[model samples]
Target chain A: MSGGAERRLPGHYLKSKEMYSLPGLVEYRPVARYLFSAGQAQSRFLDGLKEGKILGKRCPRCGRVYVPPRSYCEYCMAPTSEWVELPGTGEVHTAVVSYISTFRERMEKPEIVAVIKLDAPGYTKGGYEFAGLFHKLCNVEPEDVISGRAIGMRVKPRWRPPEERKGDVNDIECFEPVES
Target chain B: MRPNIHVKNKVAVVGAGLTLFRRRMLETPRELAWEAASMALESAGLTLKDIDCIVIGTAPDAFDGVHLNGEYLADGAGGVNKPTVRVYVGGGTGVFVPIAAWWHVASGLCRTVLAVAEEKMSPAHPHPQGVFAYIWDPVLERPLGPNLIWIFALEMRRYMHKCGAKKEDIALVSVKNKANALDHPAAQAAAKITVEDVLNSEVLVWPVNRLDISPVSDGAAALVLASENEARRITDSPVWVEGVGFTLDNTHWYNRELGYPRYVQYAARMAYKMAGIERPWREIDVAEPYDPFDYKELHHIEGLMLARPCEAPKLLKEGHFNRDGDLPTSPSGGLLGVGNPIAAAGVMKVAELFWQLRYEAGARQVKKPVHRGVAQAWGDLMQAGTVIVLGN
Candidate 1:
């Protein structure tokens, strides 16, 4: 944008694999460690997951429920003091099939993920604000997602055994269709 | 929100500069910043001593593999002792750099400001997407093991469904932007390709093709901002900064509708009001909407109100947004064509407008008689919108 192509760009181009063999190239790997706290609302929600219960916090002002709940409502900005145990059921608002993992490695079997719009009392269907969870979907094939049959299908969480639970969101293995 | 109507001084862009954008760079991050900073200073006909302050814009520390990046880039950005500050909003940092510099001069705090943006994505091992994996909510989303492209693909698919736009319609953006990039010296993925080339490219996710995305890049861009009095002494053709606006929406991206960017609209309205321009679709002469993805350009076009909702694709198909069309957008090949170095990409667009408004862009200049130009950047989980309007 500043100088014309005549001045040329000021960098060298290298292929992904070329860097290893290049001379004088210093390779670095990050060794930073992290200890994350799930915080109060999320800690309580994880405990509910370990017990096969889906929990949300209800905003006293807006009556809006939040999953993976927050301590306060973003809209109402009021403290959420009431804890609501949800029915652990919702329909898929949107879904996608991922063939790659976090590292860009191809998977043997694709995973279907979705934003499940969880139902709550006094909540209108398809409102802008609603309780939702981002999770993996089981018992649903990739083809089902492509054909649009997976979306809008009611689903419930399939929890891990209580003995194996670690008070984590993964305690629920994946959300599968109600029939499944 | 209306910007402060009683600003102390008007700000103008006296000069701009950029280092070539490439997928991998042999130069270190500091070196990249220095190269761009020097070019910008040289263009303004001023030495480093003339600058009163420095504003640096860069993305995450993970990309550079170095913590305290702002401090690390101090020497390169000429911020040795000057009041230096780094402003970041993910990809929005590019344009936000100048916006930060504008206030420095506008407030009479600094007579001259140097704004620089640099990103070193190549330093990250394997791929930078691993760094982006940390952007998600660790408690709820990390457990799902989602790929970065999955969210973009979901948004693309939703936009396609709601707008009734086909994959072919979206492919046109890739074709147009890449062709425009053919003239860009720093373009990493520029080519003379057809829509079939985009559709036939390797598919990463269902709706996202390899060509549909911008290449990972490492580079830097910079601009020199001066007050009205200082600018007149430097260049006779200074591009004035008319107005600036930024808005950050809620981080709960999935909680809202995916078809349109409501945050961008809010930001655009704020900017247009302060710029004293009504009916941006008819008044604004040129625009550079953020285009990290092909569809994103069209999505942002609608958000900018350059075209009506779900009307960009139709206007695009008719060549209304071309270099010679009614409204020329992204004539600099944009991030889709040039490269995406996170923060540097947005600065590149604003720099392009600087050159175009001055009629100094030899080949990349649009055909229209330009006057008012708007540049915008969207970032931070699709939650941030930053806009700057410039006129000559």
Candidate 2:
């Protein structure tokens, strides 16, 4: 309202068809592909996944364990020198029911996703940092999530068949509830 | 933590401007940058000739589908033949833009700096959400086939569970922010909505409905920063950049607790200490915490120490965060109501504080006599936190 100028002028709205029909509109699809090296620590961790085992790197200086292991400790900035085999069983840190896929495509049956805090000995209880993995959850009803029963519930990774295993995060089919 | 060295000259934001936030625009990225930069210079009573340096901030190149976005936007940002640099810290780039410009003036390296931020999320095919896939670790996170909202949903769920807050409690932020946006000219998704509307909206993830999230926007914002001497010569009411702080946490986001934003808290502490602010909750009069999602505003409000941990929801219910409240937040409508153009959105928040401090915000100005204000942005796999404190 200063200087007698009004700030509200609606922007030009464009329809999809109008945008496509505009003159000098250039559309080019980018085909960028990548072959990411899982790196020193993560490579070993993924290899362990294929062998039906979970791996974490422990910082020698600060004794912090990292799943999806990094060669360098983020906190202590020291080289991670020890590879620790984890129990692969931990409580569900957080969980959500995903009704859609990566591309925003709706699925017939909603999928349950969660961050599983794998049991590692480095950090204390209620610590900020932990050794965790992001994966799908199974054997838990969607109602369990809506009712606040899924979070903090004990869970373990359900590994795929030995012959069908691959050296990737998906080697473990998904994390499932550990029946008490 | 106190800073190591003292800067030779003080910095001030003399002018700020922003283009309309929309889903799609006729103008290209550079054109949007130029339009906003021109407006900022005009408001500052300066021209490109007076600018000695330029700082441009933009999110991933994948969003705009243009590589080297900084060099591409140089001319439009008035960087032609001037010392120009582009800074990126995921969504934190918006507030980081002015923080970088502050150094240029405070170091006595430049008399005046033109800072610009722009993001165009429309060019990405399928949807901009598809481009966001690039932000995840290709080997680990992408293999899970996760949408960007999955992270936010998980974090929101964690916040809800830890705070014992229901969906209705979090929905109030969206309702309040969208209603405030009714006065924002550049707002893209401004509406008079109720908590029921938010609950009934299309459910993307379990807890995050369509109404809880900010719209994908294409827009630009700019600010003119000058040394104290140059600022006094250029304008009568230059908003001083009292402090600037930014921090990046480890990228192993899943390995950490999601309920609290430790990174944002660290950054806010850094800025507050530099500003000589002992108690942010009582010292700061207003704030513009990034609200790309409704719950995020509450998360950041606590991280910024504007409220005690888990106290934002209670305060929010009592109209403590409204435009007319004692400590109004996001008076210019935050990204939830205004548009979220990533980097541009953060710049827009800082720009709102600049306008509010000068009492030039017109209808969006808070009722309280504002002397100190804070703006913050969070970005990059929930790792980056950028904060700036300003005063009239």
Candidate 3:
């Protein structure tokens, strides 16, 4: 073990080499592609987004319509029965500005992300839990995300043009604050 | 006999095996799993034909660049044409695999179970750091442009603030674990380190430096578990799984205080209760708490009830957590020194305990005799705690 502030640790030297090599000793490969059941749920959600409409599933037993529809109620442990269509609107529960890209590499421009809590029929403080989705934030400055002002701000989904619409998550351009 | 509470039969880990931990490997994830599983089966004098079920544990599919990872690695783990179950709780998944295997055997449903945990962090395209992106909250947390180190740094800061621990005191863990890992065969980051070296290490975030963290590596570990009767029939020195506990807290991580891991404490309490241990701090002979980062080991040491919440750092500074200390912790060198294959790392710790309990640790044995040991793995958005108590 070396001493002194001037001497860098071994890891620092390794970092300076510009190559962080990781060993891949194991050999794993998938024989078949797995078609997860969750894909159906995701498809349904995307379909709603393409139509510029937000959809939710209502549990007859609990009478709570989840903004991002679920096949079953997580709490009551029962299946959801009805599908409800609603406007693409909600409030930003929280927001952050990311200076790094998805790969953790520094980016030239930062991207804004937010969690929107959509309007729902459940009562109480935590009841709004079912009404949330994660997406990009637009028409908002990065400073707004840092100031603690982005949270609880009303926002609405901005969809892509109808011609460009696809049955995928990116169908919506972004979500921005309502001028309330 | 109850469906949820207890199993009809007792389960024992008959054998365990692991490949060398390395910073990088050419083998894909399945290859690691196969090598480890093959070794474990060989040690137990059994073949895949003897196995009745399979259970796998891996941290994240993103690290391997494969989604639905359980099925992806199934064939290598010997899960083909068998009852296979994959369980994950972040780093805790390794130990949890055996726990799951125990249930399969203890339920009288399977006589022999093969459990494997593998992680291939090398496969990620742009460094595994890209994979870490998904761990953040897509809306709130991800937007902050935070590095994975940010959370660990925050935790280390909170621990130091609450426990009155200095960076030097916490750095002792890094030194000790690295030194211990020097003897570990699969260790990727083992070194003869000193506290000064740790202090001099590059600071990733304030309290946490490069030395204070574990290396990202690719590795796999496997264990063969069986019912008590089958265990005795297979091996003379079987390590019994005395107790298992797992608990998951809400994801509102920021809502709760961070000084102590109540989730880990609760999980340990449950396992201890099942093991008939009244006082864990005194009963546990050796321990391996999750140490993806150095302070995490100390933080988990307290969470495992091995020491008073704030006393671990002090005890650590005094060399009480060393292999030759009164209570050896992470005699296998731990994740910080060995390697953090995530799920595989946790299982590696459990395997070390099994070796220690049976006096099969060879050169890596603790200075003192070991009778009872605990291995705990923590994961998720800092919400999952999984623990296993073992004995000869």
Candidate 4:
């Protein structure tokens, strides 16, 4: 609506084809390589995953437990002092049906993802702070999530067979309802 | 937590400039910075020589596929031999640019500073959102394999659940902001869209239709900052930098309640205190809260104390956030309307506020007589909140 400047601002908007076809245009791709270090606490947690167990670090100063274990408690600014094995069971906090992958590629079967509030003694129910793990959910229909029937339902990890365990998050195939 | 109040000099913004926001641009990242910097200098009746120092902000270098992006953009930002510094807080980098420049003048170190922000998100292959593939934690979250939209959808769902906000209510923000963008010359995604259009648009993730988000854009924005004496010499009507605030919360975003942004509230509290405005809901005349997502605008409004928690939906439905409403927000169409180029988008919001405070914003100006305005941006895993309060 400003006079003399309508449809005028710096920079050029490239068309879809122009991006690939335009000569003198630079083209490159990310080589994609990463080697991440799993620190002392996380390495132990991974070791637990290899044994079909969930492990968490308890901050001695704050008594708050962190799943996927951080070496230090962010709140207390102190090194976590204790390791506790979890029952590998929790209730669904929130779930969404994912129709696309990391690259935005469509999937044949939509996957249900949920953040499970891992069972713990110290943390209050529905409190702001809690030890949780984000993972896939199974044995539930998309309708259960859409209808708000999946939340607050207790679920346990569906672990892969012992021989197939790789000391990774995928060791647990997915979390499924504990009840029938 | 209160910031140190004592400062040597008062700072003001003298000029601002922006480049067109588009999905893919022909110009290089440095070229975009030069264009915006040149325009800002030209508007202030000063050339690159007049700038004392430089403060540059850009998003993660991953998006542009270039390492050491700030140094690459230094010359274009008018930084050649002078001291040039780069600051980044993801999407919050734009507003943080001015905040960084404010310190230069406030510390009595640099009399005139050129603040610039630029982001070229198109160079990344597949989609810019793929950058998250690296940003995710390798051991914990990455194993789950999440698309970036999943986080936004999850938060939108949490907001809907906590505030009783329906998808219909949140869709209104996209409708309102895109409609407002139609008047903006630099707008990329501006359109007169309806809420139904948003509802029917492709749902990339649940509750997050394509229209519910700002487009991936390539653009740059710049601002000229000066000490009070330098500002008075440049222009009679200068927008003083009344206050600047920024804060970062713990990275454990999932541990906290997703409904409200406590980090932004803490940042806004700091900014409002510095400006001596107790009641932001009433004192702030016009606002441009971050709106990368429709619900985020409402989320930040409450965090900024412009509305009580869960009250933004009711206020939005009443047209209270419209351009002509009593407490108009995102009149520059915000990130939703303007286009989200990461860092540049935040600077665009501040640029719009600069124009609004000076009565220079032509038709995009709010109807109310405005004396004070605020612009904010949030980024860095939904943790960093940067705010600036400007007044004539």
Candidate 5:
């Protein structure tokens, strides 16, 4: 049975309010580590990241190249053998402005999160899906994000310094819009 | 056409029970499960000893602050030293609990299966919001310092922008569901509120608001499932478990159109096909689409094919989703009004449908007679959908 809204304690209401407020709990635990399998194909993909280059695996059955390097093709379920380098330019599909931190507390400065649709050739089966990744949008105003102009805008990865490259997912900094 | 499924025996839900949906309960997680499970077994005219096997569903163990929580709750759920299986699919675990039991009885694996679902969000130190951090990408997404509401708000905004639904329009769902919860004995947020109340509530992230969301709750719900032979001998009006379905989409939630829930549609299709239901909007007499957030009810109603995409909000405004309306959605109130104990909240929705189909819901009964009913739940990065169909 649903709890009566009128009988709801103030704590209930307050918790709901906490989601958007600033200074929220930002540091979360426990630490999580994910292991990536660097098989013959992903090893080269990892090597490319260390050298500040984006690499993908190509499937022979469907002739598709997958970014982030997959050992097998999702669509054809065939083994991939070729490693392909990409231009790393794509368009933003959606974006949002976050005033609260990851812990549901408020933040002094709001951050903009955007989903970039990568320009991988034959990445998705019919373009309904894509080789897109979620990341922060640099050099974009919150108003631009809210106005829907941030979407469909061309963007390129802003990589970190060459010496600072760690062969990790965060090696490339936020993605920035490519000006005409 | 021959059915694509095999049913060794008929399965019926004999009893159901739930704990008070509270923002925070003093009782421990195991205690909450025991309280709800005891009540369900007592209602079924049985005891823990009569249960041949047990099936339990709890959302993420993170909320309870204990990993492998199913094992931790086994004794309290009355599964000690008995064959037990814990199933999880985000919030869908509530109905999935019974579905797990359905297979046990339907496949001749057990005669009586006790299904329990529980969630205690209060145990998480500091604030439960910290638990949501793990749901995002640790390498890429988390470094952006994103709040959990961002994803939900993004989807809600996209749904509203695409469906031509106004915030005020979706507020009616909050109003109706909350009002319906007023009659619920364990309701946490049941109230007679107006759309203005929802509109005036603090906006957390543009589209999402304080009132539009369900409270983090501590509670538990349980159900008893039995084979046809055991069901007929136990009760005259056993609610039959007709069909069940679950599906998951890729983790790339934003890659696809946010207007429609393809995962929910796929799950609903699988259930309807098994139940021999050709037209859900016309065939199903009643429904409960998961409503963790007010707009989620409308989103899931479309996902369940109860209404076409972009139609739920309008239909809601037209009184088509009220308790006395043509097709009552969430007649037992919903997560918005009921209080969301995560996994337990979903199970409560399933139990409400069981009560409605059995003609046992006294004050909270829908206006019309119900021969068949459906309950659907969505969870996990907006990617998982679970559907269950029940009939008399």
Candidate 6:
């Protein structure tokens, strides 16, 4: 019944070269393409962004507004019945500077990312949850993030030119600090 | 939430087994499952013929490069004609596997269940990080081109900012878990490392270094669960399943406070209540909070109420979380030192606790006399929290 006498655990480790060079080793690249439908609420929100406005869905039962609007409220489980236009300004909830790109490759210029808690009025101030958007932060130095100054700073969306605006989350080029 | 009133039978863990955690293995995913499952049956003095049902847990099909992986792994998991089910909640799938099996036996629907979890992250070409891209929302988050580490880094920053914890304090977890894994037979990332080694490691994201993360791994873990009567017949020292709890938060992770894991708290509260444990900080003797990232262990410790909010780092500094220290956490080296095959890693934690309770952890056992222990896993887009409480 004693387990101390049991030998070491785990399977054998295979080196990359050893694995690839081995006969009968199969490799495949999946071509998974999809045309995802931006649901009704998100579609309307995207269209609003194309016109340089931020739209949120408000739940009639809970009066909670969701930025990046969903058709229903997650807390109340009620269908969102109202559309509210926000000023597209908010404070940074959290932020980080990325030194590497999505593919794990080093980037020439590091990007600053933050979760912006938008100026929606339904939820309590400094609550556990909020209506927020995740986007890049511009006009902010990477040192601002390392120094912990980027978080909780007021900011506004820097929208792309109206003529170049696309019906996507990218319509807002990046978020920038709102000048006093 | 109140306790469920429908349970008619008690469940006990009779045997547990694991395959070696490695970067790449010659065995296919199913073969890995079969190896672990077969060992578990052998340990419990049973075979596929004695199993009434099977529960399989794997993180994502993308990692294994196979769809319907549960059905694909059924035969290896000893599920041919028997009823089989696969449960997934991102990385939480490992602990959730045994949670699902606990229900089968506790409900009196099955006499014995073979709970198995496996993950093979090596199948994805280039790197598994490319496969991780699919977890993000295509419409909103995907446009930003996020690496999977971005979210962990963001959460780590928030934890540091909110709790007044520094990077040095967090590196201690990496130091502790990897050293713990030195004795683990299945460990792939186990090493003798220092905090300076962790700090000087490659920085993938600010506040997260290469060593701060668990290495991607391929492995499998299996456990045998049976009703009280069946467990008594199978083994003299069956670890009882005191309680199981799992919770999923809304996917709008950015909209929530990232400082603490509310989902994990909810799941832990449920499990503690069902186990009749009102004071977990003292009652629970050992623990394995999910630690894919070092800070996550601290985040989950507070979530599981093993330590006061923001108190884990300070306690960890004083050796309160070491194997010889009080309330030792992640004695199995956790995901950081033990290697993370995602779901299999979680099952490994549960299996560690079962062994610890039975005094069968060998060199990996904690120093204190252990009675009740808890193992937890957190995953999905910062959503799912699965917890299981085990007792000898």
lDDT, each prediction: 0.86, 0.90, 0.77, 0.88, 0.81, 0.91
TM-score of 2: 0.98
lDDT of 2 by residue, A70-151 (tens): 9998767899999999899999989999888888888889999998988986555338888899999999888998889999
TM-score of chain B as predicted in candidate 3: 0.97
Candidate 5 lDDT over B243-319, as tens digits, reads 88899886657556676788999999988998988889998889999998888899999999989989898898888
Candidate 1 chain B: 10-residue stretch with minimal lDDT: B250-259
DockQ of each: 0.54, 0.62, 0.07, 0.57, 0.26, 0.66
Residue-by-residue lDDT tens digits, candidate 4, B105-171: 9999999999999999999876877787777778877888888888777777678777889888999
lDDT of 3 by residue, B1-392 (tens): 11345668888988887876776665678888998888788879999999999999998887887888999889999999999989988867877888888888988999999999999887664478866866875433554445665556555655665676888888888888988887777778989988899989765445567798898888888899999889999988888888888888756454344567888999998888878887888888989888888889999999998898799988887878888887888888899888998889998999988888988776777888788999999988778899999999
What is the full ranking by lDDT, best candidate first?
6, 2, 4, 1, 5, 3
Model 5 alpha-carbon miss at residue B94, Å: 1.8
For model 6, how does the per-residue alpha-carbon lDDT over A76-175 read when each residue is reduced to its tens digit?
A: 8899989999888999887888888887888889888888989886555438888899899999997888788887899999999999998998999999
Q: Note the residue pairs that clash in candidate 6.
A: A9-B185, A9-B186, A10-B20, A10-B186, A11-B20
Evaluating just chain A, the predictions reach TM-scores of: 0.90, 0.92, 0.76, 0.91, 0.73, 0.93
Give per-residue lDDT, candidate 1, residue A67: 78
- Candidates, ranked, DockQ: 6, 2, 4, 1, 5, 3
lDDT of 3: 0.77
> Can you give the TM-score per candidate against the true fold?
0.95, 0.98, 0.72, 0.96, 0.88, 0.98
In angstroms, the error of model 2 at B40 is: 0.1
Worst 10-residue lDDT window for candidate 3 chain B reads B137-146
How accurate locally is residue A58 in candidate 6, as Cα lDDT from 0 to 100? Answer: 87
Tell me the spans in candidate 2 whose CA falls farther than 4 Å from its real position.
A1-5, A8-11, B1-5
* TM-score result, candidate 4: 0.96
Q: lDDT of candidate 5 vs native?
A: 0.81
Which docking category, incorrect, acceptable, medium or high, applies to candidate 4? medium
lDDT of 6 by residue, B1-392 (tens): 33565688899999888999999988899999998898888889998899999999998899999999999999888988899999999999999999999999999999999999999999886688888888899999998888888889889989988898999999999999999998888888999999999999988888789999999899999999999999999999999999899999988899898999999999999899888888999999999999999999999999999998899999999999999999999999999998999999999999999989999898998999999999999999999999999999
- For candidate 6, the clash count comes to 5
